[model samples]
Structure formats: C-alpha cells, structure tokens
Target: MLIVTTLIACILAVLFIRLSFGVIRLRRQYRVGLGSGGVDDLERAIRAQANFAEYVPIALILMACLELNGAPLWLIAILGIAFVAGRLIHAKGINQPPPHFSNRVIGMKFTITTLIVLVVFNLAWLLLQLWK
Candidate 1:
C-alpha cells in the first residue's frame, strides 16, 4: 500500500536528518540543552527544525494516503519533489545567520502551493470516489 509513499518517505527522511544535524550542531556550539538559550543563530536553527517538523509530516501523510487511495504516480512524485524542494529552500534560507527573506519567501511559497494542491487533489479524489 505504501510502496510509492515509502519511496518518497526515504527522500524526505534524508532531508529531515540533515535538518536535525544542523540543529544538533548549533545546539552543541551554543551549549544549550533546551530551548534557544537566547542565541539568535541557535534560535534560527531551532526554528528551521521546528518549522520543518511542523509542515513536512502533514504533507507526507497526505501524499501517502493519496497514493494508497490510487492517485497517479506522476502526481505523487511531483508533489513529493516540490515538497522536499520547499523544505530545503526554506531551511537554507532561514538557516542563515541573519535569515534571508528571498529564499524563505520562495520556500514558503512552494510549501503552501504544495499543501493547497495536495488538499484540493485529495479531497476531489475522495469526493469522486464517494460519488461512485
């Protein structure tokens, strides 16, 4: 059931682990065990990690469910790629010492676009299935 989802999940997991490493590296550098310790760079790292944690799971779950429900392979791949690119770009942007607005904005744009597409596509598919 999760064949395609599993494939996408692996790619996402790599990205997630990378983000986790960035957070861990920053944490050790700042010597803070919990929270940001009032360090802005550490805070930004934490935020980037937190932001990814908040968004990627929901997108992945939606993608996995859609694939299980028989969504097209191409659709799943496209969405998965876009979602990953979004997070990568977002993390790269926000991981900067002072935070880069352009990258962050573009990254968020991709994320929101992916989410909207997933929500609409999944809901429409579900409704069509119910109609049948």
Candidate 2:
C-alpha cells in the first residue's frame, strides 16, 4: 500500500510539473505583447489549474484508501496509471476547441470508477475489521 501511494504521488508530481510547464508555454506563446491574449491565456491556465486541484486530492485520498484496504496491487497500479492518463487526455481535450468528449469521457469515467472501487473497498475493509 505504501508503495502504491508513493507511486501515485510520484506520478501526480510529474503530471503537475507538466501542467505547469504547459501553462507557462501557453502564457509565453499568447502573451507575447501587451494585449488581451495574455489575459486570456492566464484565465485558461487558472481554470485548468483550479480544475485539477479540485479533483486530484479527492482522487488521491480514495486511491490511498483502496490501496490500504487490500485491493489488488495490480488494480492499484492500473488505477494509478489510468488516473494520470485520464488527466492528460482531459487536459489535451480542454486545451483545444469544443466537443472534447473523446478524452474527457474516458477520464471522467475512469475517475468515477476509481471512486466506486474506493468506496467498496473501504466498506468491505471496515466490515471485515468489525467482524472480528
């Protein structure tokens, strides 16, 4: 479980770094001069960062719980990878034009499925612990 948590944390760290760099690149590209482009880029960066911050912690917490609850290590690994992949896809989709379902849908569903797994694992763990 600790291993899984560490792995997930590392992956998240990398994702955040990439996200920051992406925002910086966007700002540098669009905000080349004194104009609205810079402001728009900043707005987009803030929204992206805010959205990621809002969801990541919850996902991490649940993922940690799942790991601690004796969920299969493979599941943990797969979920961890899926989480990062989904975030990346979602990011790419959002950074582009309209109708970004291809990535967003997969990411959203992956996250939702992980949440459900966490819930089930935690409840089962609690029940087992209480049964003794």
List candidate 1 stretches off by more than 4 Å: none
Residue by residue across 80-110, what tens digits does model 1's lDDT show? 8898899899999998867998999999999
| Residue pair clashes in candidate 2 | none
Residues forming the 10-long window of minimal summed lDDT in candidate 1: 1-10
Where does model 2 exceed 4 Å of error?
A: 32-45
Error of 1 at 14 (Å): 1.4
Error of 1 at 17 (Å): 1.3
Task: Estimate TM-scores for all models.
Answer: 0.93, 0.75
Q: What is the C-alpha lDDT of each candidate?
A: 0.89, 0.70
Q: lDDT (0-100) at residue 100 of candidate 1?
A: 98
Model 1 steric clash pairs? none
Error of 2 at 82 (Å): 2.6
